[model samples]
Target: MAYVIDGDKCDAKITWLPVSGSLKTGELVELIQLVEEDDKLSREALALKDIFNDIIEEGLTYPQLGYHDESRFKSYYLSHAAFALRLANSGKVIGGFYIKPNFPGRCSHICNAGFIVDMAWRGKGAGRFMAEQYKLLAPELGYRASMFNLVFVSNQGSIHLWESLGFKKIGVVPQAGNLKGIGYQDALQFYFSFVKE
Candidate 1:
């Protein structure tokens, strides 16, 4: 399926949700689209960049090595339809993701996405919440399926999250990730179809 509308056109409003199993009541988070026109070094963008770079430094999840400057981060994450999650009251960016066609032309019906949650905010359901939003927003962007090419085997939380969301492990890439301190590790490829076939 071709894009119903450009990814940047898909938008969502600020939403407040209670932290699952927490006594702190509800927290407000605003999901905002990231566009090329946004300042590359804006406060929100910089916060997201820090989180992303932290993940990259962990060397177990994403493939990129070293650090990403503002320009590089924006080029990679904001080049397509991207979104950022922030505390509505504090305006602190806590998480974000990017969606883009997995392949060219006819195969573009399938999209690939990358996600990151602030280390401080993990386990509070932000990742899962963003994932659930992705399930809804991706189809609206005209994608029929979502595919993750390299979910590291050691990343059990991510693997479990994807599976819990109804994504299937379609294949494994042997030694797909050359991680720091861990040497080579296998990677799982996950797929989820939005259309019933």
Candidate 2:
């Protein structure tokens, strides 16, 4: 995948190898910022609110799973996720994503991913650019298939994009999402096989 890197802003390129402590700190901050902004998108509002309340805010308050700690961030990428960052033309973080093996043992061939574009940069094609980049990186990351576990049904824009990229809705979980005024709604599962030719 071709990445537009801001040399002054991002000091590192996309690499699976872990970074030094200070650089890792930079990455986490950027990733969190992306997720925070993503929380406001119509498609992500509900799920992000739930996560913010149940995990980020609540768990941190109770010291459950060290939610407030940075080590948890490091450990997540090291153990379960292959995280990446995309810097803006100005060198600030514009987007980031994590692609991971969906399951253990026999199911390890499937990959799952989560991505977000900076709220300030949304609708400018950042999300699309990041996704296109991920498609090229998937095989190198060792994934033969890619799946999105919980796409909000209302996120038709994203649905169209993913469909254009060859993903298909394989199933839906009814009333699985709590949309503010709408109460609850179904969530769609999308999948794509990326087996290299």
Candidate 3:
């Protein structure tokens, strides 16, 4: 049930999965819309509030993302999508995730990733499956470790999922994220090492 994905630099040890009865699909069009909507909320609320709306409108694309021409949004998701996974069922996109080097130059050895699952498909072990894939894929892409920069304190499910996967708590930035109606909340950072030294 598991396969390894190897990249140019290392043996990923990742299990990149394909649609195989892991889930059932409803409407393909609706699924994409659901992913977009959830992405909009996360970008606007629990993420950087500066260009929240713009990022939502422009989306995580390359060259042109909303009104801005350049952003980590494009660089990570659009540029480094080679090390990624697209989860679907019945030709409908259930989830997608991407892993990128967390920084440039000296910090390029470390990586970061983001996963988004359609709202309707949540609570069905989709995220857990994707997270496991990313952890393995990251190492093969020449990364020694992986990091989740900002996890909203209110998102108990995600916090629990990452922690259960052996990712450690690096630090917390209090009242750093705005949850729309909920004002501001703490953002937690998590890290996982492929090779523990």
Among all candidates shown, the one with the greatest lDDT: 1
lDDT tens digits, residue span 145-178, model 3: 8887778787788999999999999999897765
Per-residue alpha-carbon lDDT of candidate 1 for residues 23-93, written as tens digits (9 for 90 to 100)? 12367776776645556466767788899999999888999988998888977776677777887777778
Better of 1 and 2 by TM-score: 1
Q: How many residue pairs clash in each candidate at the backbone level? A: 0, 1, 1
Candidate 1: worst 10 consecutive residues by lDDT? 16-25
Please provide the root mean square deviation of candidate 3 (C-alpha atoms, Å).
Answer: 10.1
Candidate 2 per-residue lDDT over residues 60-122, each given as its tens digit: 111124342333443342233333334422345444566666665567667777665455545
- Per-candidate local distance difference test: 0.80, 0.52, 0.55
- RMSD in Å for all candidates: 4.8, 12.2, 10.1
Instruction: Please list the residue runs of candidate 2 whose C-alpha ends up more than 4 Å from where it truly belongs after superposition.
Output: 1-69, 75-85
TM-score of each: 0.85, 0.61, 0.64
Candidate 1 ranges beyond 4 A from true positions: 1-25
